[model samples]
Target chain A: GPKVLQIPSHQIIDMGQMVTLNCDPVSNHLYFYWYKQILGQQMEFLVNFYNGKVMEKSKLFKDQFSVERPDGSYFTLKIQPTALEDSAVYFCASSLEAGGSDYTFGSGTRLLVI
Target chain B: GDKVKQSPSALSLQEGTNSALRCNFSIAATTVQWFLQNPRGSLINLFYLVPGTKENGRLKSAFDSKESYSTLHIRDAQLEDSGTYFCAAPSNSAGNKLTFGIGTRVLVRP
Candidate 1:
């Protein structure tokens, strides 16, 4: 069974600070994705990355948000100048291929901005 | 328009009862996956279907690509099955992007 692991299960940060969320995808997975869920809302897709580049991103992925797969070690999502609205549960998911594949998700990292 | 919509926002069942949860997709979904989010907030994959039915333990799920809908049936529900269930659909044109339903909260009481 494949599993995705996310670090810093819970994070608290002040507004305007920079926060980085790390994800260690399955070793054999080729596609990684980030999803966000506000309290009481459905999960929304943020972005997807593959081949060390961003494949697609939703409108919720703002300019302050960035993702990278540096050194093929960990896929990370960084948010600079975080806003209060950014407070939500961030989930990291990975799949073997681009489409029609079941994705494995981590337990998620809860981010709080004050 | 919501790409995915789930029915019965919340449900409560007595132990040993049976229930069904559903998801309707507005998009041309090529694949469907169901997940259960437990009280600990851990999302566990239940079923992944492509226009077919799959059964595991007391859970059964079916997806119909032509109708763009999916159903999850729980036979003889237990307290451990109490959680939020979500169905996600990836559109044929979206390229690996999944749109999730708002989720159905189920509470099973003894």
Candidate 2:
């Protein structure tokens, strides 16, 4: 089975600080995605990246959030000046292709902003 | 409005019993995917469906694009099956972003 690895399984950060989450997607996967799940709520899509560019993003992807995968390295999501509402489990997923392709998800990085 | 809605927000099932989880979609979804989030918060991909049915070992899943719904059936449930089951559909035709359901929490009791 393919695996997406997320670094820092749990993180506690102060509000207004910058935090970056790292995701090591499957080596052969080309499409990457980020999802946010608040405790006791449904998971929401943040954004999707392909070919080093953001393809699509949802309203939940605030202006303070950004994503990049430099030189095919670990895909990273950075949030600058984070807010308390940003505290949630972030799950990263990757797929070989888009359009009905199966996705492999990471265990998730639980970020707690205090 | 909820785009992807799941039934029976929580369920308690006895081991070796069978249970079925369902998801009704409000968006125009061409495909459906089921995932099981374990206690450790791992989203394990269970099934990727394309308006059809698929079975793997003790689990079975079906997606009806015309009906805008999907179903996941767990047969002869085991303790390991206790988890939060979620069904998701792509937000766009490219299938890039996924909209997930609230999830059905299943607690398998011995």
Candidate 3:
């Protein structure tokens, strides 16, 4: 099972601060996705990136949220001026193709905004 | 307006027993994926399907495109199986983003 590695299992930041979550998707995988799950709630889609550009994003992906993979580096999600409702576990996933095959997910980073 | 609906929001199962969870989609879902979130909060991929069936050990899954639904069956359920199970489908036309169901929490009892 190929693994998608997420850095900093847990992060605590102030409500109006910016925080970046890093994800190391499986090597050779083309599609990358980010999902957010609040405590005891459904995991919602944030955004999906491919070819160094955003493919599609959900309404949940706010204007303040952005994702990028600089120079083929780690795919990262940055939330600026985080809100209280932004506190949740962020899961990173990757797929080798768009055919619903070889989708691997990271352990997730639990972000807490105080 | 819920695109994906999962039934049995919660269930309690006895170890070694069998049970099935289901997902009915209102949107056009060509592919379905099942994931299990353990107590440690790790989302583990269980099955991925495209209008077909797949089996792995005690877990079996099937997706029906014409019916717009998917199913996950657990045989010989174990205590470790106690967790939240989620079924997700890629956006009908986008094929990139996933729309997940609310999830079903299963508790395996000894």
TM-score of chain A of each: 0.97, 0.97, 0.97
User: CA shift at B15, candidate 2, in angstroms?
Assistant: 0.8
Model 3 lDDT, full chain set: 0.92
Each prediction's RMSD to truth: 1.0, 0.9, 1.2
Which should have the higher TM-score, number 2 or number 3? 2
Instruction: Name the runs in model 2 displaced over 4 angstroms.
Output: none
Which portions of model 1 miss their true places by more than 4 Å? B92-94
Residue A87, candidate 1: C-alpha displacement in angstroms = 0.1
CAPRI verdict (incorrect, acceptable, medium, high) for model 3:
medium
Error of 3 at B92 (Å): 3.7
Tens-digit lDDT track of model 3 for A42-109: 98988889899998888899999999999989999999989999999999999888645688889999
For model 3 chain B, give the 10-residue run with minimal summed lDDT. Answer: B90-99
Q: For residues A1-114, what per-residue lDDT tens digits would candidate 2 score against the true structure?
A: 768999989999999999999999999999999999999678999999999999999999999999999999999999999999999999999999895456899999999999
Expressed as tens digits, the lDDT of each residue in B1-70 for candidate 3 is 8899998899999999999999999988889989999999998989879888999999999999999999
Q: What is candidate 1's CA lDDT for residue B84?
A: 96
TM-score list, all predictions: 0.97, 0.97, 0.96
Per-residue C-alpha lDDT of model 1 across residues A1-114, encoded as one tens digit per residue: 778999999999999999999999999998899999998678999999989989899999999999999888889999999999999999999988876466899999999999
Which tens-of-lDDT digit does each residue in B1-110 have in candidate 2? Answer: 99999998999999999999999999999989999999888888999989899999999999999999999999999999999999999879788788999999999999
Top DockQ prediction, candidate number: 2
lDDT of 1: 0.92
lDDT of 3 at A41: 96
**Candidate 1: docking tier:** medium
DockQ of each: 0.75, 0.81, 0.73
